[model samples]
Every structure is written in structure tokens, then in C-alpha cells.
Target: MNQEFYHELGHVVLHIGNQRQMTDSFRRYKESKANHFMYHACVPTFMI
Candidate 1:
């Protein structure tokens, strides 16, 4: 319903009137490796 979603969908669908999916998409994989890898990568702390 949003423009950004439609824009991204268009890129994935080749402007076709159907939805398309990406393969080997690690980013979307639940329990994705990025979670494990990026965990604790960023945090705010006060130190002298």
C-alpha cells in the first residue's frame, strides 16, 4: 500500500503484475546468520 513497498516490489517483479521472490536470501532467513554475527556488535556504554 506504500510507495516504497510498491517500488521495491516492482524491482523484484520486473514490472510484471505478479509477486516475485528472491533465492539464497540470507537476510530474511529466520534465525539468520546476521543475527548471530551482529549480536553485540553495537551498543552504547560510558567509559573513561
Candidate 2:
């Protein structure tokens, strides 16, 4: 179950960087936003 959650989270994080509005410029990209959110949310990366 934990592995499943990690897999899903990775997908969400990767997709955020590909969003049309967010992909306009690399500097303004939100690619790391999801990662930061997950870290703060206590989503352990060890499981990933």
C-alpha cells in the first residue's frame, strides 16, 4: 500500500511540471512544488 502511494505521488509531481500554464518557462516552472508538498506532508521518500 505504501509503495502504491509513492508511485501515485511521483506521477502527480512529474505531471505538474508538464502542465501547459506551468510549462511556459523553466524558471517559473512548478516541478518541485509537489515534492516540497509531499515532504511537508510526511510522505517518506524511502518508500519511493
Candidate 3:
């Protein structure tokens, strides 16, 4: 599950970097967004 989800997320990241409106859609899917700790932890890397 993690592998598949990670790959899907990778695609999202690619799309975000390539498109503007796509990031809005991606952000919408994230709901409330990552918690503070998770955001901080992933900040240097992904961060939602």
C-alpha cells in the first residue's frame, strides 16, 4: 500500500511542479493538511 501510494504521490509532486492549478486540486485533497509535527518533519523534503 505504501509503495503504491508513494508512487502516486510522486506523480502528484511532478504535476505540482509542472502545473499551477493542479497544486490547488492537490491541496484540496489534503484536507486539513499535515499536523504541525508532521509538517515540520517533512519540511525539508515534502511537507504535504
lDDT over C-alpha atoms for residue 7 of model 3 = 48
lDDT of each: 0.38, 0.52, 0.45
Backbone clashes under 3 angstroms, per model: 0, 0, 0
Per-residue error at 22 for model 2, in Å?
4.5
Off by over 4 Å in 2: 1-18, 21-28, 43-48
lDDT of 1 at 12: 49
With a 3 Å backbone cut-off (N, CA, C), the pairs that clash in candidate 1 are none
What TM-score would candidate 3 get against the native?
0.30
Model 1: lDDT of residue 19: 26
Error of 1 at 32 (Å): 32
Give lDDT: candidate 1, residue 30: 26
Model 1, 1-34: lDDT tens digits are 3444544543444333222354455324422433
Range of the 10 consecutive residues with the lowest summed lDDT in candidate 2: 27-36
| Candidate 1 stretches greater than 4 Å from native | 15-48
Q: How far is candidate 3 from the true structure (C-alpha RMSD, Å)?
A: 10.5
